[model samples]
Target: MRLRSIVLIAALPLAMLAQGRRNAPPETPSTKTPAELRAEYIREHYTKAEYQIPMRDGVKLFTAVYTPKDHSQKYPILLMRTPYTVGPYGSDNYAGRLGPASEKFMREGFIFANQDVRGKGRSEGTYMDIRPVNPNKRGPKDIDEPSDTYDTIDWLVKNIPDNNERVGMYGISYPGFYAAMGAVDAHPALKATSPQAPVINWFIGDDFHHNGVLFLAHAFNFFSGFGRNHPPDGPNRDRIEMKTPDAYDFHLRTGALANYDEKYFHGQTEFWKELTQNDTYNEFWKSRDLRQYVKNLKPAMMSVGGWFDAEDVFGPLNLYKSAEAQNPGAKNMLVEGPWSHGGWARPDGTALGNINFASNTSKFFQDDIEFPFFLFHLKGKGDGDKLPEAYVFETGRNEWHKFDAWPPKDAKWKTLYFHAGGKLNTAQPAEKAEAFDEYVSDPAKPVPFTPYIANGMSYPYMTDDQRFAASRPDVLVYETEPLESDVRVAGPLKASLFVSTTGTDSDWVVKLIDVFPGDTADPQPNPTNVHMGGYQMLVRGEPFRGKFRKGFDKPEPFVPGKMDQVAFDMPDVFHTFRTGHRIMVQVQSSWYPLGDRNPQKFMKIQDAKAEDFVKATERVYRTNSAPSSIQLSTID
Candidate 1:
């Protein structure tokens, strides 16, 4: 019996190994979603704790702290301050999930903290949207996000038990705005930060508007929820009622921008009213911009954004550039992926729409960049150089790249000029042939931003096939032949258009696209319903409010039937027009509902009536004297 027992004991290791191998999960399939598994793991390992953390101005903010149950070692802090409600409402009620980046932070053992920004959610005080920093702040009573963050950090390090002296901060969008603000005049304990898709300047770019052009659907829906004043007991989910499912039809029927307040809002949303009132980059809008204030940043910062980000793509680029320009010595890193707004926060990052990034890009970012960043900076537990200076993912090619500087130091600037009969070429225009393409831009039948049917701003439309838009007579389509060589674009695309309008005012919407060949193949056994063949993938697009052509603050009326220069910079495109793909450009006067109609008359559009809307004949000149061309920052 003793000899049998010894033999069984010796066989135990082999038996366990064989059992583990037999029970292993399949490479292709999983019984549960990643989110479900992460949620379960977080709930089991962490405990929920709530508190009222006091800010510098004596404002007590509601905060939720999730600490690891294991007391084996002290953990560093990861903080996020947001206007978005951080609640399950009770001390015992834990969040469905915890941590800054997946369950990775929780699993790695960090004390995660989420706070309701002053005047938001359960926090005390009057809430302000994109709250401006007070550069001249002197007294303890004077406060802003930075001050609030400083006070919060001061309290956490001293009061919280089993905490290491280091701290890290991160958030997306509005919370991202807070993360940026916190980095300015950072707390001593605040050692690292990752502000993913931060809101930079609302008036110029990010969310509400782009280069002074109003984003109607995003602004309207967002203000109805986020911009409205909520009572202490009021729910935060109130949305503007869409009269019809068709956005283009609804906006056209709704008439002018005046209708939003008179019909639907009834003066309820204060910020919407404020937004309309300020049409230019006045002190009001400029003060709220975070770029000017992001100086002398002590935190080891990593600014993350997506190339196809529906919102805040401008933020990451501008913020990183600003820090480099303003505060030279600060450790500023940028990572831009081929993602929509906040796509990196989710589990699946393999592909979007018809495009396959070939790998789980988000997983790579979390595992390789984001987690390693804080772990090294705050915990001193990982390699410091894991995340590179400028780690950007190249679209079309679907590959990751690291650069010493952004816009790539070696990019060759080239112009893709428009020619007669919708041909876009790299050659210069003929000196004598001063030709122009004309299109009738009717406000009554304005161009839809996307072909799909949706109530609000469709984020997927950012990368959605532009084939539908190309078919429209109102939209002038220009394209190059299927590329002979892979032409990679590394920087911003600038549109230098010489346009004339029959009416006094108009808008110029320019789109840069990658036209996939009809014979091109999608991934094997395609996972998405999107047709990849002949897809005119919208790489980058932006609308320039024509009145702001001469200047943003100064309104200029276009001389009727006379050519005037309307040039503006479109967002940067870190994409490659593959060897078999064609490069395309689509130009139009109006993108309805996506942007408020121009009324085709040069008075204050915000106050224009239904009758003010008119059709206009717009001409885009493509000649040597006044050549309409798009300049790209091409990289070898």
Candidate 2:
């Protein structure tokens, strides 16, 4: 692929500004004063200091605060609590305060605090798992990070002299989870916060279970990294060394994920042990979930997440909804951009895999939007404004839109039925018992998330390799009738299906896809003639596994012969399937290497031996009693 010039024209209408949150100020006229430039430079050149503060539990957590030296008055604080160590500063002396990565907020003279969570960095306290404010087990009410955060905020207010009595929080990935925790029962001093790419739902949404099936790569990688640093102890980064295998050959290596217990569990990883041991939905995971604890959310929040964020997308979206439902009075905003997991924090926002957004969308949001959000909330002297409750970057349209509530109020619940022979149609099949789609799901050979295999760290969500999946005989692809109008889906989605299998337990994956008609493969379209950055198509997709359909806890197995109606919730999407495009739904038994393979036997997931890797024939039943359908939030 040849490189285009760095200058890609900004496509959005300049006049369309200032519509959301009382129309933003006209793109701050390029400042051109010697004094003004000097002020901006100084604001971006603040010094950073490292310190360790003790929590109420007597745990000392490390923190790095970047304060403006020209501090004539008290300034509000912007804090980021993270497990990943916060790097101090750049090597170049004159290069200044924080790097360009933080140029937005730094240029606004706001105090930025980045601290390592307990059990990480120079912080003290035994690092347990992502312990929420409420523990699942019936034990002593042990203090968690939320308590630690309250203690830290209390200490900062009285001790840090040149500080206003206000603070805001935000972070990406794991740090995002901490930010969410910080808001559970936020400190009195905390006024505003944003949990970007936050871990809102653990088992069902975040790192592990997706729709019920365990996210194999994410799970294996995370455990390999964090599991190496087991509980009742501090974070041990040195113990977890990633094992490198050939990219394409990786699937073959991971025969039965349950076998991992025999290889690695030296009696230290009880969670990992429990994870593999309990493949069925049980009480073990329900307790660790954060969805139930998302009540009484304080701090006016701006929940940010990536539409393509492979790791924590479900968490942030679900978090925003839960917050809205639980605390309707609290101000909450959601900003979703076209980027990979925490990719916005990086410099370039190019194609994650085969799809490209045609611009550095991440940089645009960080510099133009996210920074201003903090400045407006934390500092009184911002652009004198506020952003809307939901500011989403629509992918297919290549534009931005805002609304008071998610799913936009006018969206309707539309169903796209699965037709015969891998066909997706709007009309339900007239014949009641013509046939069913059957596929044998072998635990030994499961479908990979991508065509090419790689480490878990590689961009998983950024890909267009449906060709490999389409080739698999086991996969079922159901598409919908071409839409007569533009259908906009913007909220939580659910897939209800009637299924049966020959084995006691089996996994079924339901995927919602946006199929775009392309020009015949032979002729290459002119580059200059490219309409909307050559993206003349829309292809959005999400999948959910079967067993955990009802919920993470209390998973009942297939009775070997009876039909089971399963409802799996698909992740939310803000898509506009245009007039010519079609909505699609693909049902299959496996999304593997990415997701751990289920044994079809209800035993422990991680401890299944080689003999437990049985090949089971799965059946999809579509009758009057067993109606399988895909439901979407469409434009009313």
Candidate 3:
């Protein structure tokens, strides 16, 4: 629910921490339990303190600082700024854990600080979602995330006891945005920063919208709880009560986008209103694009994300590229693991759903990469020059790969073309005539994004089997023969579609899949008794709003039955299709409640009437002149 929520690294309780340590020795009737031992250890080793740290704008942010009890040596300050509460509230209450990930940071002993950014929790000043960075700060009043971070750091180094004049910042999701912002024209003491799965551009590619298409279920469910205003330091807003547990049915029955405000939100949620009004990629969205502001960063940086991250997949990849390009010669690195949203922070990262990576990838990242990164920059404890530019996990092969540059400099661009008889190959379509595959997209019977029913966006849907979707008449399927050798694909995928619609507009969904061989065996203890043979594992999928094909800011209606090009870049993937696996592609007009209904007519979809939602016959052209294909960056 709420799209797995923005994971708070230090929010893990003693009980949950104990539960995650599966191999820990069990407690006898007289001996202390793992939870008790951990709680005792934290209390003994750390001293907690609360502060109302003032920002440049005169607003005070609530920060909880946990310093090492052993004050023999000064420690670097590791800070995380979040809109979410930095709680356990009172000075007497101690967090079960500290740092960006794992108890390793706690054991390593640093001054851990977590702040509730402006407006949320006990913080003062109004909270603005993804606050636009102020490029020209004329006065102290001109404050943004960067200024607040600077103020916080200045205060910590000058006032906090037993502090080294060094600071590091890291956070996931919303806080990751703060972390990235802190790196821009960074404070002198802020030596290192990591923004993992940060929310970059909301309208383009992030939580709520993808290519101008509103992620209906995610936005709706998320805002239902997080979109409201409340008294400072109060509890989180209650989630909207759903009439039914099935999200697909509930969303569909809720009717047009207008119905959401009319029935549920009742114009109460300001952000939801903003989302509806800013349907196009206008200044409202552009100003909040973190990519443009990452220029000339000063801190040693690392951008982290999950290959199957359901949310914010676009953030880490593009942020890393932007920082690398803008900061030229800066110590910028990218780490992508075979994990879901915030998966690297979790105790286990061996698998997501049925796909297993065959290693404790999270532990590897925490111990080898993240810890070393901070140590080198913040504490001068490791070889900073040794870190790779790109540390990515290659799926299918389930192995880690380091590269001098992402997309690997040696990888070549190749196209996988769609052909007749559901065949997909590297060869260009030979057909001279207008050959195409057609499907009727009816709003009444939309294609479900996943096989199972849920009340919210299911995180596992990122890599779930696509057999259910492929079997639908409304979806087009194309596949290649089993590979003779491993076909490894790295970097972003580009979907270039030559298409036509009976209606003026439509939504095009593209999915890249790996088909397991018929002889493949099921997992050793498959509790669900799932068949592995012919499993169509979805590696990546993205939807494009047809109207925005020209540009995100420019929306144009399609000429019915006239061929038009709809091309967009999906997030990158590092995956290997082994010799026994077949590469598959599925294209559809509707991904259903995963994205709001298009109405198949060119108008403000948020204001569409029921009659505007009509059935449209969609065609994907694959002629010699109009070859529709997916461009991939592959390693030969």
Model number with the top TM-score: 3
Model 2 TM-score on a 0 to 1 scale = 0.84
Which one wins by TM-score: 1 or 2? 1
Question: How displaced is residue 558 in candidate 2, in Å?
Answer: 0.9
lDDT of each: 0.85, 0.67, 0.90
Which one is best on lDDT?
3
Candidate order, TM-score descending: 3, 1, 2
- Encode model 1's per-residue lDDT on 1-636: one tens digit a residue: 232233365657887857855896544444766566666666777887889998877789998888888888999999999887887778777777776655567768899899998887789988888889989999989998889999999999998888998999999998988989889899999999888899999978788898888899888878777656565535665566786787777777778899888978888788898888898878898899888888888998999999888876799988888888987877899999988898888787887766778898988888888988888998887886666689999998899999988889999888999999899998878857658899999988888988788787887778888988888889999999988999999988899999999999889999999999997676688656567789999999999989898788788888899889999998888999999899999999888688878888998878888889889999999888888999999999
TM-score of each: 0.93, 0.84, 0.95
**lDDT tens digits, residue span 1-636, model 2:** 001111122333555432432554433445465345544464445666767888765678887777777668888887788766565333222223342254556655677777777876667776666765654423333477777788788877777768997998887777777878888777988887778888765566676766566776677667765656533224455353446654324645646665565555465566676666655555656655666776777777777888878777787788888888888777777888777887777777755654556678778877777777777777755661467778887666666787878868887887766667767666666666635777888777776666554766356444343645766878776765666878777776778878888887777776666656553232234443332321223244444555555666666667886677777667777777767676666677776666777778876566666787788887776555565788887764
Go through the candidates in order and give the C-alpha RMSD of each one to the true structure: 4.6, 7.9, 6.0
Better of 1 and 3 by TM-score: 3
Report the backbone clash tally of model 3: 0
Task: In candidate 2, list every pair of residues with a backbone clash.
Answer: 18-23, 18-24, 216-595, 258-606, 276-605, 276-606, 277-604, 424-479
Question: Arrange candidates by lDDT, highest first: which order?
Answer: 3, 1, 2
Cα deviation at 362, candidate 1, in Å, is: 1.3
Better of 1 and 3 by lDDT: 3
Error of 2 at 154 (Å): 1.5
- In terms of lDDT, the poorest run of 10 residues in model 1 is 1-10
